[model samples]
Target: MTREARQEALERHGLVESGDGFTVTLKGFQKAAERARGLRAQGNQEAALMLALEPSDPVRWEYARCLQIDTFSTEAYESGF
Candidate 1:
């Protein structure tokens, strides 16, 4: 999808743009994260984990790490830290 289409979907899904210009909404974030995981499950590992990330989240770095590990493993591993 185009950036504009993604933005429209986000808006239609009730994600609001914060002052910082990033989308912010718990429901939307969760949905995006879930979508990301589904992408992984469907063998779209890169797209899946990319969708799971929120730049402002403190856990973003960890999520990236998880993505790397997830790429190599058949089973998902939880971050211990």
Candidate 2:
């Protein structure tokens, strides 16, 4: 997806972009988790898992938690949870 689309997704998922624009949101975290899962599902398990395991802001803590619970043994939980 385009950067705009990604930004919109983050907003839709309840993430607000900081004034500096570098901060990560709950939505962005969730999107990353989703991207990871999608990559895994497409047989790119390494990439998918990597995406999910990246660090995010506290705002995304909840989103990461959810992804962790869902993915369980995956590295997504390591970064997100």
Candidate 3:
């Protein structure tokens, strides 16, 4: 993605570009980056990026389900049963 698109994606996902160089504070963004890195290592860069960019993806919601208790309720609703 272009720099503008990446910045927009970060904002859309509620990430703030704070902290020292290359560091991100948002837990969700950290998790997404980890997941994306793993996917990219496995040669699935497109899928990795999609997971990072698309907050509406069921996979993203599911991933969040494992990360935070508060996410469960919202993810359930977002998943549409």
Query: Ten-residue segment with the worst summed lDDT in candidate 1?
Result: 72-81
Model 2: lDDT of residue 19? 80
Against the hidden reference, what TM-scores do the models get?
Answer: 0.39, 0.36, 0.30
Residue-level lDDT of model 2, residues 1-81, one tens digit each, is: 556655554455445556853344455465657766776788985645565544644434554544433433243235442
Off by over 4 Å in 3: 1-25, 47-81
Scored against the true structure, residue 64 in model 3 reaches a CA lDDT of 42
- Clashing residue pairs in candidate 2 are none
Q: For residues 1-81, write the lDDT of model 3, one tens digit per residue.
A: 556755554454434454632223356555655656676789885646556556766666545433333333344346553
lDDT of 2: 0.51
Best by TM-score: 1
What range of 10 consecutive residues in model 2 has the weakest lDDT sum? 68-77
- Model 1 over residues 4-79: C-alpha lDDT tens digits? 7555654544355557544435555455466567777889967554655565655653454343334323221222
Off by over 4 Å in 2: 1-10, 13-15, 51-81
Candidate 1 wrongly placed segments (more than 4 Å): 1-11, 47-81
lDDT of each: 0.50, 0.51, 0.51
